[model samples]
Target: MLTQTLPTWLPRLSFAPVNTAPRGDTLVVVFLRGAADVLNMVVPHGEDAYYQLRPSLGIARPDDSKTKKEERTVDLDGFFGLHPNMSPLLEAWQSEQLAIIHACGAPDESRSHFKAMELMERGVDDERGPASGWIGRHLATLNTGNSSPLRAVGMGTRPQRSLSGSVPVSALRSITDFHLGGDLRALQQMRAALETVYAGDILGQETLSIMDTLQKLDVQNYQSPITNYPDTEFGLALKQTAMLIKAEVGLEVSAIDLGGWDTHFAQGSSAGIMPNLMKDLAEGLAAFHADMADHQNQLTTVTMSEFGRRASENGSLGTDHGHGSMMMVSAAMWTAAKSTGSGLGWRKVNSLGQVIWRSQQIIVMCFPRF
Candidate 1:
């Protein structure tokens, strides 16, 4: 029998209405911090202008005999394709669970990373005024009548700005630390003292909710077969995320950010820094996909950066900050596309949803080369 233990707040602790429960669907946001070149990451090989513009940095189309198969984009409906580094996710896209939203942005023109990220996270279209994050709003909308302590969790030391709101969210370094063990009487006493401290103020309410959620995370049982994660900070972070998802604690949202993509220097498209970074990201995400294969239907992962780099490479073999980025939605959303199993080129439709270009539109063709 399945038992759901709803948390009860002590009289001293304050509380707010719990957000709506998940419909069993999960939204994972992969924030690719640092400006990543959307054009290079999502190669527009079929576009002549792409090749013509970045003679040194441009990736070749699928049929380009000079390009190695492993380095080429996996075809997707003959238009936009996945980078060779992202071959792991290709299967997901082929499974029709993945969809790509190109030329879409935060609706803010600010080039500053801080400002752009703020606008995107806050979900404000006009780029003005204080507003909650989209996920926070989504959580608010999802909040059901009764409070479920285990409804939302962010897998880290502190909750991302996107997860902050009136609702209480759990921030965990690991599942092991979320619960208390030992004597029941001692546990109750400790909780009582904590509750006494929390009851009198705004923090009291959040403390109650957070403690309840942690307790829930503590008891959840989960196991995964032997797996290896890279030693990098981002790599470890992703591995932890996989563990939480596998735990099946009713997680509805997970936020992750991977940085060092700001390739203003030595941004090699084919080899060196950029390629290595892409490789790490690809491997991390691939491992995550593999770990959650069984739960694909209930999960959708999305990756995004603030903006793209310049269309051309600089003297230092890197690219500068530019505009118009790309987003990789789970292939699960477009099950039909993944079924076909082919690479694709660029197709340009402006941010406003107008078809500005028909055949493989890369950077120069997609944007005005500003």
Candidate 2:
């Protein structure tokens, strides 16, 4: 068999070394690819305008007779209810770690996915802008002397554009698949060769540091012994992230993108595409939360989409892309007192009120209020 030698610039395990602190603070960014109907996900039942606008697909209020237990939106307070699809997340909200930001969207007016994604990833509103990613810039700011190996990670094969910068960062694929499962001598050779290849490249060096962190975790038997995560892509990805954190790799930030939110056809308000995806999202996130319960303060999860669907349903029994969507931030980092008032308690409202922030700015809400 022909053994393909991985590129010298590509990180293998063992090359870059990082002197990271034990797990401190963690931030998780979830990119819900395609526009999600924010109105449906975080229904403002208090708004008569919302019901009037979305006649067919409007989510029923928790007290409505038409609302089924599973189908009814979880009451955020009394004004808003989570879409039945996102019940799992609602549970987290009840626990005080999950928060929702309503009417949030890219600062730019354009609905173009390419443009929106770029703006979000860059964390900027420049129409003609710099190529560096927003998270990447954040990492650059954190590059203190010791440059920890596992300071940042993106949970996919390709690191999101946000984490692309001059700082060292990594993407975790599979915890098991990432390690070199071979002999000691071969691993040593691979490491020596990699050090030479990444000597000049900054990103390469950072990736090398990530690899070193993974190797150390593998040796520590840090796999989740408590929770049984589902066998799906998102679940596995989250599990891997939890493992990295549990291993005390000093992971500060991570990103994961879940596609299929562009519900053009059977978006399924009662029990369809949106709900199923939300279930997976909720379950996966819940599992991660449970697994890292002890490290709650060290982590935060944020979910966002390019935009929200129209206020009304379309002819296809679904929704079209529209202005303003919802963003959810896990409350893992906030205190109970802070989260209660600061969190967007999914309350019922009487009118389609003006969004609380600048239309051109991205909305970010910390869970648990603190």
Candidate 3:
């Protein structure tokens, strides 16, 4: 049999020069790939305009006695509520661990997913900003000296655009399968040969780091206390992310993508494709929250989309790409006292009635620890 090297697509474990000590909370960024219709996800039942605009696709108010429990939105506040399928997140809300920023999104006027996403990830409004990703730029500020091979990770085949920069990031599909795939004997021999050939060199150091990470992630002992993941790709990704955080392998930042949010057609209100996606997102996030309960203080999860859907329902019973979406921030440390009444310099909308969809800018809520 011909000997084969590791696949080219496999992430290369390398390190960037560190300046300051690694400090700060672990930031887990969840990108809702398709522009999620935040208007529906976080229903603004208080606004008569919302209902009037979204006639067919409008979610019923939380107090709507006529709708089924699974059909009506779960009221978060007097005005805003979550979609019925997103009931799983109510626990976080009630616990004061989650904060929803309504009518938030990038200021870019481009409704194109690619352009908006690129600009958002790059953390720039126009073409004048640096090419590096926001997270990557943030990582550049940290001094991660000789840290674990997995400092920053994107839980997918390709690294998320937000993680693109001077920092070395690993884009992984499956944590379990992240290894030299082939004959065991050949792998062992190649490893030994490489160790000898690059001993005391940077390559050798990175190789040793990879080995150490693999050893730490010994599949058997790293079981999560919370196991009820939805068996979807997003579920698995969150599960693995929790596992990685639990392992404490210097995971400062992790980016996970949950696609299929572009509800251009058949976007039902009470029941349909949107609800199912909400279920997956809620369940997966809830599972992750449960699994990482112990590390709640150290974990902060933020969800964002490129842009939001149009305020008005289209003729196709769906929504078109529009401005002013919402971003969700969940951190066990975010108390009502800390987040309430404090605008953190970001524009605050007291109610859905006050939200100016056209002028709304996506606010990147950075916690104190972040």
Candidate 4:
């Protein structure tokens, strides 16, 4: 029995009551806005076609003979490899906690970022699909009775389309700033007045709950166990997410965005724009995974983009919008006892050059347990 009403004082956002004993894993969805170039991110060193397609942009194959690892790819399975900048994620792969879904994307062929993002976020195959997001629908189906006010959160100025539905979700820029606005004396007066006005109703009760949550989320005093997070916006978002999870405030889902992936010019190889972004992404994710190691059994993180870059590089040394992209999933819910395979029954490519593109539908359908 989740409460769905929005408080008038907090008209900007909404909250939901979480079940005392909810069932299911907490989900973190990372949206790599501005289509990421999967081809170079996950290097295909074995494929000569890949090297030939973008001779300048392609990453160098893994070389044991080379003294400098920065100039080459980090071999994952001989044929396929990771961009050297993303070395932070190597451990996750080795431990089998990370799974890569190559050539995955929405069915729509439109390369427009807005349209593509809308389609993907809505979890619809066509333009006329339902308005509610896949995550919103998923939460609507769950039996989370009157859950925590922080059930689903979008970490930014606005909530992503994925969390749009009947369920109350919060859009947060910073947890530290989540409070009643006013100076010291004004704040005290406002709080006292609000308490008097909401003394004995659901609104008052929920307001008290929110106050308690804010106190619990005293982010200024929290310290992350992992120390390698990049000093970037993405890193900060993930750090806050970890804090919320550790607080056990009934956060069932979170959506974070990392933009600037639309590399259309001078996208360098091993030492350029792409590499820096890749480093930020890899380091942030790796740090989050390490910081939340104790709660890995109940956490699942997934990364997706609107689409992929063109198979071939453009004249500007970057790439244009392309058909197929990739998805990455790191889940503690998938135990060592379960099959390590993607479970989607898609063919696994081991060679660096092999291009596997099929009608895999968008990632919403690929969500675990959906």
In terms of lDDT, the best-performing candidate is: 4
Clashes per prediction?
A: 30, 15, 1, 11
Cα-based TM-score, every candidate: 0.73, 0.78, 0.85, 0.85
lDDT (Cα atoms) of all candidates against the true structure: 0.62, 0.67, 0.75, 0.75
| TM-score, prediction 4 | 0.85
Better of 2 and 3 by TM-score: 3
lDDT of 4: 0.75
Please give the lDDT score for candidate 1. 0.62
Question: Which residue window of length 10 is worst by lDDT in model 4?
Answer: 337-346
- C-alpha positional error of residue 298 in candidate 2 after TM-score superposition, expressed in Å: 1.7
Q: How well is each residue in 213-290 modelled by candidate 4, as lDDT tens digits? A: 664465544556456567888988898888777655577898999999999998888778888999999999999988
* Residue-level lDDT tens digits of model 3 in 122-216: 99887787999999998888755635557788999989999999888888778866666568899889778877887767645564655545544
Model 1 C-alpha lDDT per residue in residues 1-370, reported as the tens digit of each score: 1234322211122224334334436677778888777777767665666666677777767777888977777766665666677666676666666666666565554568888777777766566656777677777865344244445566677777777776667776665667667699998998888778867765445446655544544323322343445566666666656654543344577787787888878777668777887888777777677667776666777787776665556677777766667777663444364322123233333474322212122221110000
lDDT of 2: 0.67
- Model 4 alpha-carbon miss at residue 330, Å: 0.4
The CA lDDT at 327 in model 2 is: 77
Point out the higher-scoring one by TM-score: 1 or 3.
3
Candidate 2: misplaced stretches above 4 Å? 1-18, 143-146, 181-226, 336-370
TM-score of 2: 0.78
Stretches of model 4 off by over 4 angstroms after superposition: 1-24, 64-67, 202-207, 216-221, 335-370
Q: What is the lDDT of residue 317 in candidate 4?
A: 91
